[model samples]
Target chain A: MKKNVFTTVTLLARSAGILLFFLYLGKGIQFISHLPIPGSIFGLLLLFLGLNLRLIPLDYVLPTGSFLLNYITLFFVPVGVGLLQYSDLLSTHWLTIVVSSVISTIATLISVGWLYQRFAK
Target chain B: MIYLYLIATILVFLVSRKLLIPIKSPLANPLLVSILFFIGLFSFTPLIYQDYATANLPFIWLLEPAVVALAIPLFSQIKQIKKQFRAIMISCCFGVVIAISTCLSTALLLTDDKILLLSLLPKSVTSPIAMAIANETGGLASLAAAVVIAVGLLGALGGFSLLNLCKITNPQAQGLAMGCSAHAIGTAKAIEVGNEQGAFSSLALVISGILTAVLAPLFAWLIGIIITI
Candidate 1:
């Protein structure tokens, strides 16, 4: 039991370290370049390239990735809770909020889905 | 104090997940339920949103690395993904355009506040990028973050059924729609649906984010034209 637990910790630390390194590299590049894009995005691209190049073995990060994906929903709770900060603004402008969020998301979903479904032709 | 807030957030989330499972509806989404739990929980406690936000700072920081980890899913699905790359890119482009236009026109129907309009411009993308875009375009970052989360929640809840209603049988189509329209929350839901969906959604989230960043100014300008008329 101790051996298995220790192995899990080691794997998590190593994988997190590698992911954080990429994340920082992305931040550095974005800082220097004055890019409009988010650093996390740059980090994501770099990591994808690294994997494609075989520089980082897939097994090295797969467990961490799966774990993150599994619980990504939980991570959004805090930010979602940040909704409290704007309750006043939201309530007054409820109409605009409804129209924008509801209509926009539905339209985008339908259009993108419809467009791509036809793309195979 | 901090531990109290952290413990509350985690406990609320875990319990919400467990309780929401048997019900099995997106409206009862665990994230939505937990957020509501905190929002309600706040009214009873001496704490405020800022306190909870501060305690949960680490989770926000984890978002970027989580995004980086998305490369794993992308890598896993790369072979099949490459075959449909162009189609996915084209669909994402259209999705971004649709998201912006619909949001702007609909919001314009009710009000023309520049800051609010600018903030809503990036509502369809992930919160981090949405906030950045909102700030760069003379919008309130805080408002942008709020709107982004709202949009993500809305999509995460209704995106699947709506896609099905539209007869979008293709996983790639469904995933791309989720990513571009819903961003991170949608991607999270897509991951729950299946790996292929998750991979494609991540790809579209990144692509749509980049597109929105590059075109944010144009949308901002469009808002100017929109309100002036």
Candidate 2:
């Protein structure tokens, strides 16, 4: 029972940390920058800096980070499902979309790999 | 209540995943299956996309925290990141420039529509970043989002064949290529390969997202110039 209570408290603390970072730090920067980039990206940078500065504890953020990352793909499902609304647009340009993405994806993969091997060595 | 929709969505994904356990295809991602399931429901049932989106807002909001949480893995892998910092930066730059230019030029050749061209500009980045950039650049955000997902799914499914064809053996290079090219979904596939690749992929995702955010407008302007020429 004691350990169970401790686990609950830990979960709560971790979640609180995550919320504060996203709601406060992340959104705050977005409000300031007025750039097209999402606030979460700014929040990520702040979190990284905070961690390096020891302002945010690793133990505090690790559980939340890993937990959220594990389900990162799931969170995208709603938006993926949102794709159904675009059936007409997608079908209209299906050839360009498929051909460009496939060709570019392969091109990127090859180029990055080739550059990294050359530069790293 | 909203909880019902949330539960049902998760349930559908779980069921779809379970059903695909025997299939070895990388294309059978939970995101794809769940989206298909939801799309089917929307067609046959009374559910509308707006209602589903509104009901699922809380879960969608979790994406923010997930983004913030990315710092942890990045921090843990800082040593590797620092060691190869220059190479990583250079390769990511190469990847982004190559990705954007190729997609734009090809789309431009296929259609004279500029919005469609802009939508494909940020396709190499993650969905949120792509959507945000698309909106700012006069592209259709919704179309960009869908295109982003399609690019991710395509990369996740067929990326490895390209890697094998290129004979990319270094885990760092592989992760860099995957993340730079495919964004989050590619990173997911990278993680499945190994921890090191996962770290580099995560790094690539963040850096490439930032680069695309900053450079997309400039790239769009350049595309305009090239078109006029």
Candidate 3:
């Protein structure tokens, strides 16, 4: 029992450590580029490229990456709760908001899908 | 007391996810359920929102790195993605253009509020990028966050049904559309559909995010020019 607990702790620590390393690497590059893009997205690109280039071994991130992905939605729960802060505005303009979002979402979905389907064919 | 707040957030998420297995309805989305729980806690209980927010710092901090971790699945499908790179790129660019234009026009049809317009402009992008675009375009970042989620939820709920209606059988097409229109939430939904869909969705997500971040500012500038004229 004690050994299993220690192993789980070690795994969690290793996962966070590697991911944080990549995150900072991405932030560093973004800083140098002076682009307005978020560092996390930059980190994603860096990790992808690093894997393709074989600079970062797949095994290093895979175990932790999959572990992280399983809880991906959990990470966003806190941020989504922040939406409550705008409940007042959301209530007042609910009509405009819903109408626009629905129309916009459907329009983009159709346009993008149709265009891609045609292009692929 | 602080422990109760933290435990409540985690407990709600776990129970909500368990409930989702039986419900299978997107409206009962785990994230939505979690958010609603906090809303109820704040409204009915003596528990304060600010304290709850403070307790959630650990989860919030994980968000960025979690995004970074998306590279794993993305890398897993690189071979297939590379085979059709040009088509995917073109589709993503086209999607970006359509997303911004339609969202802006639809919102304009309803209201002429600049902040609302700008907030909805990046509604198709992910949260972090959307917030940045909203801030740059003179919109309320907080409102943009909510607008982005609203749009995401809509796509997640109806994206597959809508794709079927459009006769888009191609997983690539469906994935790209969902990612381009709905961002992360939609991508999550796509991932559940298939691996190919997940990869393409994430690819489209990255490309569309970059495109929107670049083009949204230009769009705002163009709108400003037209508004002044």
DockQ of each: 0.81, 0.70, 0.70
Worst 10-residue stretch by lDDT in candidate 3 chain B?
B220-229
Q: What does candidate 1's lDDT look like per residue over B149-226, in tens digits?
A: 888999999999899877897888888999999999999999989888888899999999999999999989888886
Name the best candidate (by lDDT): 1
Interface Cα root-mean-square deviation for all models: 1.2, 1.8, 1.7
Q: Which of candidates 1 and 2 reaches a greater lDDT?
A: 1
Please give the RMSD of candidate 1 to the true structure: 1.6
Q: Tens digits of per-residue lDDT for model 2 on B1-229?
A: 7567788888887788788889877667676778878889898888677878887787678877876776777788888788889999999998999999888878878887788988899998888789889988889888888888888878877777678777888888988998999998787777767777877887898899999998998988987777777
- Per-residue lDDT for B1-229 in model 3, tens only? 6757667778888998887888755577777778777888787888678888888888777777878888887888887788777788878898999898877777777777777777778889998889888888898888888988878877877898889887998998999999999988888778768877877888888899999999988888766665555
Model 1 chain A: worst 10 consecutive residues (lDDT sum): A62-71
- Please list, in the order the candidates appear, how each scores on TM-score for chain B only: 0.94, 0.89, 0.88
In candidate 1, list every pair of residues with a backbone clash: none
TM-score of model number 2: 0.92
Question: Is candidate 1 or 3 superior in lDDT?
Answer: 1
lDDT for model 1, please. Answer: 0.87
Clashing residue pairs, backbone N/CA/C < 3 A, model 3: none
Worst 10 residues of 1 chain B by lDDT: B43-52
Clash tally for model 2:
0
